[model samples]
Target: MRSWCVLVPTAEGELVRRFLRDRGLLQKHLAIQREADRLVIPTVSRVEIGLPAEEREFDEAFAPIRSYRDVIRIPDRVRPLLPTSFDVIGDIAVLKIPDELAEWRDEIGRAILAWNTKLRVVAQDHGVAGEHRIRRIEVIAGEDRTTTVHVEFGLRYQVDVARAYFSPRLGTERMRVAERVRPGETVADPFAGVGPYAILIGRRRRPRRVIASDANPVAVEFLRANVAANRADLVDPREGDAREVLGEIRPVDRVILDLPHSAMDFLPEAVAALAPEGFVHVYGILEAADRTATTVEIQRIVEGEGRRLRHLLVRNVRSYSPTQHHVAFDLRVGRA
Candidate 1:
């Protein structure tokens, strides 16, 4: 097994490992090592991962992944890598080849254009640079550890700008709110990361109010920047948890509950904070990957609110960290 250490931002250290570990290939091909606050993943290849079958047979196969490219041990430009991934949150993509092959990056990028008809690339000295075409790719810092710093070099596109607001990428949870939020209505996003739903809604429709909030200072900073960058006039951003902010804030016509990991836990707060007859977009990454499973979770929240899950809209936004259903539900609560 060939190994190349992968260094990532300290904040992303855990996620970096989980993202790769969730793939379950670690036992067979990869290994994660921790050095202080950084992460190191020994990838197994010098070649690219091929396209996985459209339909997976195994249960763990749906894990969120950067690409299906076979893990590479050695770094090489023009190494036929699957430099893009759509199924993961944030659409996270990686395309760092060794600086040794700066020329090869362009050559390989052109070849990729042949295989992936939709993608377009603008190569710099780095590997590849283009959002939506390729979300991110930079040299993994190779120092005491093999990890390289994430140095992005690309044409910042709409998606790149939009990334300022999304958690991973714009999941169904966010898209649901964008489609449903009406003009002249206030929408609250409790767990707004970089304001994807809020900013997107502001641009797409006439939301009288859209307040997006996040506890992570890093996320909050970006959220504010994104809202202002796009349409600062209508959308107001608050930095804090929904539980803390919504309790003291005014009412909203609609609410987007996107903290799927803890959304159910916050149902009480969401329902209590909701406006009379207001719309609530609740998201939950459930175990059962179906509408029935989603409804069950929705009912759990509306149990005592004198509200029933009147109408349930279900969508599989994307694979949630693999195998866990990344499910979104539009619940119309009826007065009990």
Candidate 2:
């Protein structure tokens, strides 16, 4: 018996996996990082079967992307803006763009449509980039070099991801943190990016109030637009970190701490602002080998605060690096 692993970049893998269907080539390996330009695999098969000669028949037959060239790199941001920088995290092609651009937004978008053939525009940054803010353009081009636009792409977001862009990955760890809200409960999202969670929750759950914010002005503008677009029930959109404006809002039944790098440092302030028995969802990515230790660290933080941290459950969300894991531990904080 012989066995091996072959890692192919997302675009290439996506191109070939269709052929290997039911052959048992794809394994459930942890897709560590998102923006992978190529795929590294473990496989005993070494023969490269090139694509058919009909690739030129379609508008977008090859991969679609542009080089950010490290002028700036979005850190810890898995689902980023498109056609700028990209990496392959498992079978997905993660794309991201810069924070600000003058006139090239449309140009950048056209580049994506030109590169990734019949690609599905899964997400977008809002109409700040005009009609093509961040949408999943459904263009299909494959082996036969056939291109078809089946669906005129609509917003992937059931709720506009404008004013609050909660990282979609966070849902892996904190499943529907906002979706569980009851009517008349106050909620706040301090680090809303384009309102990933806020809009969905506000529109669906009927929360009494939801205050969302981001330090980035562009993010705030998008958040507001998303709130309006989705018809968010009761939300107050702000443009700064939640901690700074926490004093101005009603006491919240739940608080989402999504600040990058040091959300743990915000624990003290978060505890102070939360209502009695309020729930908090925290995000942290640690090494795979450290899963046990990482869970322990989260428990110790809330325990050290002398509060009773209940529901101490840990979720291995996604893969960041080779041996590193993106983990989220959720707990309910109350008086000790």
- Residues 1-336 of candidate 1: C-alpha lDDT, one tens digit per residue: 335445555787667557555765332333455568664454433223331112111112233333223332324545544344432122222244455655555454444344443334322223223321222433221111211111111101123322232333554445556787767887788777666666777776787877878776656776676566565567787778678877866566777777666577777777767676677877776676455855776687786665666677777777655567777777776666
Question: Least accurate stretch of 10 residues (summed lDDT) in model 1?
Answer: 146-155
Per-residue lDDT tens digits for candidate 2, residues 1-336, read 222334456777665554443465433232322235754333224434442211111121232234432222333343254343443211122344455542344444444444554443322333233322333322121222211111101222322233222334454333356556777878778777666667666766778878887777766776687677667757788887556876666467877776534566666556667786877767665766766775676667767766677777677666655777666666677877
TM-score of 1: 0.54
Residue 315 of model 2, lDDT score: 71
lDDT for 145 in candidate 2 is: 20
Error of 1 at 240 (Å): 1.3
Q: What is the total number of backbone clashes in candidate 1?
A: 24
What C-alpha lDDT does candidate 2 achieve relative to the native structure?
A: 0.53
lDDT of every predicted structure (CA atoms): 0.55, 0.53
TM-scores of all predicted structures = 0.54, 0.53
